[model samples]
Target: MSSTTTSITCTGLTFGWPDGTPVLDGLDLSVGPGRTGLIGLNGTGKSTLLKLIAGELTPLGGAVRVTGELGHLPQNLTLDTSLRVDEALGVADARAALHAIEAGDAAEEHFTAIGDDWDVEERARATLDQLGLVGVGLDRTVGEVSGGESVLLRLAALLLARPDVLLLDEPTNDLDREARQRLYAAVSAWPGVLVVVSHDRELLGLVDRIADLRPDGVHWYGGNLDAYEEAVAAEQEAAERMVRVAEADVKRQRRELTESQSKLAKRVRYGNKMSANKREPKIVMNQRKRDAQVSGAKHRLLHEQRLEDAKERLDEAAEAVRDDAEIRVDLPFTAVPPGRRVLTLRDVELRCGARATLDVHGPERIALLGRNGSGKSTLLRTIAGGLPAVAGEVETHVPVRSLPQRLDVLDDDLSLVENVARLAPEATNNRVRAQLARFLFKGARADRTVGTLSGGERFRATLAAVMLAEPAPQLLMLDEPTNNLDMASVRQLVAALGSYEGALIVAGHDVPFLRDIGVTRWLRLDGELNPVDPEEV
Candidate 1:
């Protein structure tokens, strides 16, 4: 918990994947005590940088230096189902040793194991409780807890270790509202050198600073996400102004060069005419012509150099501006009348044995909230007709499409156009290509195999395929739509869904994102589907 020392530093760091795709090249960074939020678009090496710092990955070049012990929580956490909570917390041995010593065992090994950490069990329990794991006993097995609980449990283990530095990657991806609050509290209280890579806006808001990773390197910004955005916006505005001024300067230089050339030519013609009319000596005429030619050449060179300088300035100004593209589309056919019935659940029994009867009218946007393994996804699949209901009936009055969390709707071997064409068999290839372009996969990008696309690109492609299907799906169901997406892609998804006029049933734990997308109704799925207030969620 000391705050006076540097925790992590990388000097001339470089790394690349096995396929020779360069990620970080000669990158340098240093971190001190307090929390720093690491953010960037998908495939920008945010996670990769964390791994390098944690020594989980060895850099191809340069060196990483850590001042103290470090602990890391990966994005995709997996634990043995048979592992006990104490074992996962890394305190099982110490706890057993302490109990054995108390039971009158004089074994030197137990004493040695207990060492100076005689209060390990108490610390572990306190850490777990701090993370909102009140009822989860240390003796409980990993399989007895939910996925969100597992995440917090792992974090508890790291906290118990009391390392001087910590790294967390997307720690709140599957956490519900209450669990997220617990995480926010933990982050706010962390006193060590903490660097977290996340797209969760609320989580990022707790950080003391932001580290934006780019192709060139990492750029530091003061304050949290909102401050960083405001600063960047102001910078972009100034850059644009500079570009405009540079452009005008270039235009003026070009015009002046053209006018000067015209005047020089006219003067040369007049001088020649006067010299010939006056019948001057041949040597004098030749000297005058040579002088005129030299003067014209010098004038042209000066103007051309000025024009080149202006162009270079313009190029630099343009580079300062960020021009990231956004997805914009119009799906008029997907709209439905307010009074039209879109879906009906007649005593429908979910795959998890939950029964619910409900009617969805028009384009009602519903936000499904639940903890991990609460069957939010199961209900969505059942409604989408991807899964058979255990009992009762699910009736859909319009075309339904589901975008699963796994994004398995598209074939990896096929191109984006081909995938969309497969979903909409009636649409011609040209039409499909045109629609795909609207999703930001223009021309050749649409032809690239899905396997070649990045995580964000794949999500966009999957969304495009589902939304562009034939009959124009009037009912769309999405499961954990924001999982693993970068902030930019999340914004793009929100924008795209904003334009969607279809009935939406999105199951996700991202509360801020759900609110931003304008959810008309909020429903919580526990043992049954029931309406809940947005504030409760």
Candidate 2:
């Protein structure tokens, strides 16, 4: 620790929940100032390590040292209902006092001593402006905003706190294109130590380092996701060699064991034959007895023990160092009708008040691209039956199922199993359980309330429910399906979509993701919700 820099150096840290297996075992980490992206498969100890560094949880064996103030944004954030946006930044108290003075309740001396509401409002506005939220009213309640907006609100508050270390877990999961860019800008400009637990490839590319958490321990590399992936591949190849060597050794030991057993059997046969002849006081017979008991017996026992030990060692060497047994899915199916019109929008208008965004498409894939408020979602909702077509006909033969950006179609209060039950009432409970397992939701996870699920989990559960129906939707409408998913999941989902035979209408700004998922067309919208020319924003 020094005045110029803050660092966390932990050695032999071992921690886990009560009654649960160890998540981090004798782990070591030395993190200093700079952005470090944390990536791992689900159930890894990323969140736990965040809690430990923040001092919310203690290490079971070793100590954790944090040099300065740290601010963390967990996936789920709950704020006090009564607190306003400005109150989060310490300007509300001053504004409240000034408001009282204007109402003639403030003491004359105190009123003159304290600043007025107008002054407080100016300061709050400046702070909000820095966060690109100046246009929004400071009085707006957190509960009134969408999850994406609330996330920014919390980030603003945290940024204003001026902590030395900032940890954000899945921070961009709920953010749209614009907000995600804003987050990237914030981290890129930050001068403090930052650890982000995220699966966003775009975000990962901007980080100074990438650290992967495995079951055994953590490994840090001085590059982004791509470089880490390459290094990991090399390491795995090397690790696999250990298994081959151990296997070879085990085989040799087993052969030796068999030979020793045969030799002992021959000795027993010879001894039994000599005893049957009733040889008495024969020196040769006595010598043969000593050979069988002292030499052959001891050698047989030792060789047998060696073989067992060799087998165990082989098993240990073959233990998992890579999780490559994951499912491989490539959905090669389409729903393009034989006719000229796969889908249509004749005066297809979607409106929120006086604004609208419209689309007219043939039997082709189209990307609806725009800022979050540009009414991209509204257009998709109208097509998927979530919202009525305000003043147009959306003709389509194939069934359309939408993966809304917010995934609001599913009730947040219900568990995944319950939601799936509602979606497919004809299916039995056992059938539903088995179906859920396909989407990686097993047992208790399927029973956990949807409200408690993260954005990624909700998306996975929703996809499982939608695709389980008998008649596949000829048209798939996805609004930012990859927003909350990790990079690997995104790739998997994209690969599936690429092979999809059905018509696709996706609203997302992930350029590479769109390309990977087979975007055959692209459409951009404006803030007025009206159709803008493809070239013009």
Candidate 3:
């Protein structure tokens, strides 16, 4: 916690995948005690950097140094279902020792275990309560908690440790609104060196600074995400201006070169006439021709070099400007009539015992809001016919498609084009490939197997397959659609959703994403489907 000391440092750090794809090359970073938000596009090694700092991954070269104890919360955290709360918090032994002593056991080993941490249980409970896990008891098993609760429980464990350096990657990916708020509060109150990599704007707003990771290295920007964005915007504006100026200079130089060539050609024709008519001495004519040739060559070389320099400057300026592409596709076939009923749930009982009675009409876009394990996904799966309802009847009057959180819609061994073709058998190979290109998979990229694609790419492929099915789904249901997606992918999803003319029922924890997709109604799932205001969500 010293003002002058750095908590984590990396010097000449290097790492790459087994396929020799370099992620970080000779990267040097130094982090002091404060909250720092690490951000970049997907596959930019943001998570990989955190793992190296936490010693979870070994770097190919160089070194990572930490001044004090470090704690890390990974993006995909899986805990044993049988693990008790106290054990997960790392206080089981201390709690056992304290209990044995209180019961009059007085064993030497018990006393040794207690050491000076007799208040560990109290601290653990207090930490859990701070993270909004109020009713969760130490004796409870991991399976008894919801997905959001499990994430908070892991964060609670990290808080109890009180490590000097803390690293969190995509901490709010699966958290509901209330849980995300609790996490934001915890991050604001932390008094150590904390580095978090997340796409959640609200979470990034809590950081004191931003560390933008790029292929070259990390670029530091003071203040939170908004501040960083403003700075980058200004930088991009300047870069654009530079590019324009460089382009104009190149054009002007080319014009000058052309004019010089024309003048030189005229002079050569006049000189040839003078030599043929004997208008000058032979030696003078030969000397004059030699001089003109040398001058012309030098002039052309100078102009060409200037044009090349201008082009290089233009390229560099363009590189400074970010170009994040969005998905653009139209699915007119998915449109439904205004009076048509897309889906009907007739007193339906979900797999998780939740009941619902609703009718979705026309192109209504519904946002399903609920805490983790609240049966939102179950209802979507039931409607998609992936799971049978416990009781009652569910009917869909139009073509339906469901995109699950696990992204299992495509075959791992099949190429992206092949996957789309399988979903829409009537569409020819050329047609499928053309549609896939709009999803940002062009040519060779479209031929990549599903298993070899990155998380964002895989999501795009799955979405493409669902939306481009043979029947063109009129009732589309998505479960946690934004989970594990990068910001670019999320924007692409929003773009795709904006063009859909069919009914939509998307269950997710991302409020910003839901709002961006133009949700017409908000429904909260508990024991039944209840209408709620978007503000409440």
Leading candidate by TM-score = 3
- In candidate 1, the residue pairs with backbone N, CA or C atoms under 3 Å apart (3 or more residues apart, or in different chains) clash, namely none
Each model's lDDT: 0.88, 0.72, 0.88
Could you estimate the TM-score for every candidate? 0.89, 0.75, 0.93
In model 3, which regions exceed 4 Å deviation? 408-433, 443-455, 469-471, 535-537
For model 2, residues 1-537, the per-residue Cα lDDT tens digits are 354564777788888755344568898888888889988765567777888888878889887887888888876566765667776655666666677777888576545545443576675676566656655677876555555666777788777667888999878765777788888888889888889988777788888889888777787898877888888888778668878887898899989989988888888897878877977557778877887788887897898888888888877777835643232233334446445355666656676432343443334677777765566777778777778866767766666778886577688778788888887788899988887876778787788777655456677778877765535566788887776566666765765565566777888767677777666666776644344344442
| Residue 125 alpha-carbon offset, candidate 1, angstroms | 2.8
What order do you get sorting by TM-score, best first? 3, 1, 2
lDDT of 3 at 5: 96
Cα deviation of 254, candidate 3, in Å: 1.3
Prediction RMSDs, each to the true structure = 3.1, 5.4, 2.3
